[model samples]
Target: MRWGTFTSSNSVLLLIDHQVGTMKLIQNIPFETAKRNTLALTKAAKILGMPIILTTGTENGFQGPLLPEFKELVPEAYDARIARSGVVNTWEDPEFRAAVEKTQRSHLIMAGVTTDVCLYSPALSAVEDGYPVQAVLDASGSPTELSEQLARQRMERGGVTLTATNTLIAELARDWSRPEGSELLKLMVDDVLPPVF
Candidate 1:
């Protein structure tokens, strides 16, 4: 993806099934890291004011609601919760479609609980539909690192833009001199940049 060029205009973030239950099964990145990284992305999305949409599958049966941090970061996101029966592919759900439509943007930044199941399906479908898609890799995970890597390869082959949250943050920042400077720096140090430092 052309990073700054495309992301600057028609990009929306889609967080799929990042709920309590689904995250517990993710082993590639421990549940804790998954939780932290997901929240990091959420924080960046909110700070950047990007169009972010969230989804949950069968939450009433104990999947639980989205993580508390995410809830607090983007409370307005409640209206975007896509509840589905068994549409493994989030893109297949009508509610998901409506949420995406509401963004009024075509480029999509997507992440989900399970690397292969939750993340892959929509990415492939979205690409097939001719929409530019960015898969936020660190924010998505599976039971094993190998599986996660393979799923990433699969998404890559399908023409999805796979990237990290830090990359997205920097891309959105465009130039540090912009008005989002302090906010971006806060996100970088508090969430995106610190680990590497």
Candidate 2:
């Protein structure tokens, strides 16, 4: 299927476990890259006017709160700190599930700190619920390259389409003629696309 089939209005962006808590153990994808993609996602979501749902697990003392940058990105999003423990799978969070439902969008755009535990779980759950899920794989981190591959494979099997942050931004832009076009192009150049052109 075409990757950009889900437009901004029909999509819901879910940022799972982007907390300073989960940021500590990330390994495979360099922390800087993950941070950039996460930040890019937040910025794109805000620009596209997509519904933003943010969730954190054990943000109180066990790990840490969501990064200040992300919180600053979408100060109006429904931010919730779920009380459940054990499991990077955020679909189990009541608040997360409710927020997803509230968005009322059938297409889900997802990314998380850990590829397997954080990104994979919610992708699978959404697939089972008959929703089209697009996972930003590179934006999601893992403990190792091995785990990252496995996480991506599992989600693919479950029908989650994988994409990178740049591909997604370009797809959404569709053309550099929209009102937000130039600004988005600048964003891709500054964040996703390198200075190769």
Residue pairs clashing in model 2 are: none
TM-score of 1: 0.91
Query: All candidates' lDDT scores?
Result: 0.80, 0.80
Q: Which digits, one per residue and each the tens of the lDDT, describe model 1 over residues 55-143? A: 98888766777777765678788655777887899999988898898779878888898988899989989999888888887788898
| Candidate 2 wrongly placed segments (more than 4 Å) | 1-4, 78-87
lDDT of 1: 0.80
Which residue ranges in model 1 land beyond 4 Å of their true spot?
1-4, 195-197
Tell me how many residue pairs clash in candidate 1.
Answer: 0
| Ten-residue region with minimum lDDT total, candidate 1 | 1-10
